[model samples]
Target: MDEKQIIEAVKEAKEKSKKRGFNQSLEIGINLKDVKLEGADKINTSIKLPNGRGRDIEVGVFAEGDLNMKAKKYSKHVLNKEEIEEYAKDRRKMKKFAGECYGLIAQPDLMSIIGKKWGIILGPRNKMPQIMPPNKDVKEYIKDLKNTVRVKSKKNPTIHVPVGTEDMEDQKLAENIQAVYTGIERTIPVEKIANIYCKTTMGPAVKIKW
Candidate 1:
């Protein structure tokens, strides 16, 4: 969608979505056409929003020793080897923990162990932890992930991703939406996109003329 149309759509969507007791997230939905939702044809990737989603994105880091110390300093949740084992045993607790964080990053050395133990729980939900080199800076990675939104097409042809919160300016929200649209367009051809829609957490979807 053009900048003018996107701004107009965001304004209309914001107006339609009344303020709630809690801050509501603004989401963008895109429907696909002609693309077969099978195997590698599915859409699954992380896109960084230029204006962010207007919230603090909690990051969980899995590491040990010096790396663990660095990760703990920057991330809200840090899981050491022992803690990872503990979470592995308790599926319920692991699921709850995963739900609380926007994404997870792990020490590269622990990838195999994490995959073997918790892959079943996190993989299906697209919460699989990213691998980070032990020697690399943890703060930079956490900062980048804070501005990212996960977009994936699993069993459905349509995907919805949070662009920003209702509290953000209309222009900023429009820019965020455009960033998401461009990211998705990179994955799938423009002709494959059937429709695009925007909505708030509690509001009805409003179509965007792309």
Candidate 2:
């Protein structure tokens, strides 16, 4: 798709949307053709928008020892080993916690327990915690995740993702949409994309013509 077309569609989408009390997130829906949501064909990955998500993204971290203390500075919810098991037993609490957190991170040591206990809940939602890389600062991963958005296709060929908020510049939102499009294109051919539409949280959709 042409970059100019994306920016134009974004501008039109915002113009059509009603102003809301809170900042509305800008979203794009990419409808694909002949793509199967199975095995390697499935779409499940993260893309870091060049322009960060306009709103604050709260990440829930699962860590212990020094990492746990370090995570405290970046995330509000840092679960230790015991706390990990605690939240696992209560389905209600785990669900609420998952809903509140935009992303999740975990220490490598806790993967086993987390997978055994919480995988069922977090797996399908794509909220499973990203394991922290060894010898790396937890802040780097958490910060990047805050600006990233997950694009997944479930039970449909259409992939929906939030590119940015309405408050962001049109050019920035367009670049984000392009980033997501490029990411999907890496898996599915561009010719396989049926249509691409851009819209705000409560706005009417505007189709992008290239």
Candidate 3:
């Protein structure tokens, strides 16, 4: 879709979406056609929204020693090897942790340990910690993850992801939607994109013409 069409769709969606007690999120849904989801090469990667989702993203970091101490300054939650095991034992805590954080980053050496303990809990939810290279800067990783939105097509031909919130400018929201669409197009064939829809958390989906 062109920029003008996306902006118009955003305006329509916002106008139709009445103001509720709480701020609603702006969502983008894309339905695909003639796409095979049988293999492992599924669309399951994160895309950084150009204008963000109009909110702060909580990030969890898994590290140890110096890296753990350094990560604590930038991450909302930082867990070491022992702390990870402790959290794994508490189902309630683990569940809350999984739901609360937007994404996670872990030291490369501790990935196996995290997988063995929290994999069952986080794997299905797509909250698995992104492996941070040993030599890379943790702060940079956290900053990038904060701006990212996950896009996954596990068993369905449709893709649904949040582009922005109701309070953001229509143009920014449109740009974010375009960024997501562009990212998906790079991975999946553009011809397979059957339909595109934009909506609010409590609003009706408005179709956008490509």
Candidate 4:
């Protein structure tokens, strides 16, 4: 789908979103084409958001470079493998972080080895590995990557996100939301379900004409 199609769909989705009971919604722009799956048969996962999710995200970064150094200066969750696991060891906090953190990022090597343990808790919640280039600037990337609006379904088979705001001059929110939606779309299979919708957090549905 092109930009117009995504925008219109998000407009249409706003009303449906209201019936579900949300004060506001955000977009999670992910590259749908980039998501690769391990299994072909089953797709069992939950999209768990943070409590009072209406607030903007702090965006935690986990990298092996200066990003780690920067991340540590900001928050305790910003740490190496051993530290993260230790922090996650606290049953309640682990359950909360594992439940609500938007995404878990790492250098590719670390991801390949330790993704399994983290995946055990985060995978089912649509928070999976977004393995990044090892030397990428961790803090800066986290700012853009994490401050997204979510366009997800309510524990159903299909989800929607606000691709663009009807009132905004630019479509940054729309694009970001679609990217995240696209990533999630790739995570599932075409055979399972067909499409994802985008709409406003408070607006009604507008059909995206092809």
**Largest TM-score belongs to which candidate?**
2
Question: Which candidate model has the greater TM-score, 2 or 3?
Answer: 2
Q: List the residue pairs that clash in candidate 1.
A: none
Looking at model 1, which ten-residue stretch has the lowest summed lDDT? Answer: 36-45
Alpha-carbon RMSD to native, per candidate: 1.8, 1.5, 1.8, 7.4
Candidate 3 Cα errors over 4 Å, as ranges = none
User: Which tens-of-lDDT digit does each residue in 84-113 have in candidate 3?
Assistant: 999989888888988888899898889998
Q: Which stretches of candidate 1 lie over 4 Å from their true place?
A: none
Clashes found in each candidate (C-alpha, N, C closer than 3 A):
0, 0, 0, 21
| Candidate 4 accuracy as TM-score | 0.53
lDDT of 2 at 140: 88
lDDT, candidate 1, residue 119? 92
lDDT of each: 0.87, 0.89, 0.89, 0.51
User: Which regions of candidate 2 fall more than 4 Å away from where they truly are?
Assistant: none
Model 4: residues with Cα > 4 Å off, grouped in runs = 1-23, 26-55, 63-65, 72-76, 108-113, 147-157, 164-167, 170-198
Clashes of 2: 0
Q: What is the lDDT of residue 94 in candidate 4?
A: 55
Ranking of all candidate structures by their TM-score, best first: 2, 3, 1, 4
TM-score of each: 0.91, 0.93, 0.91, 0.53
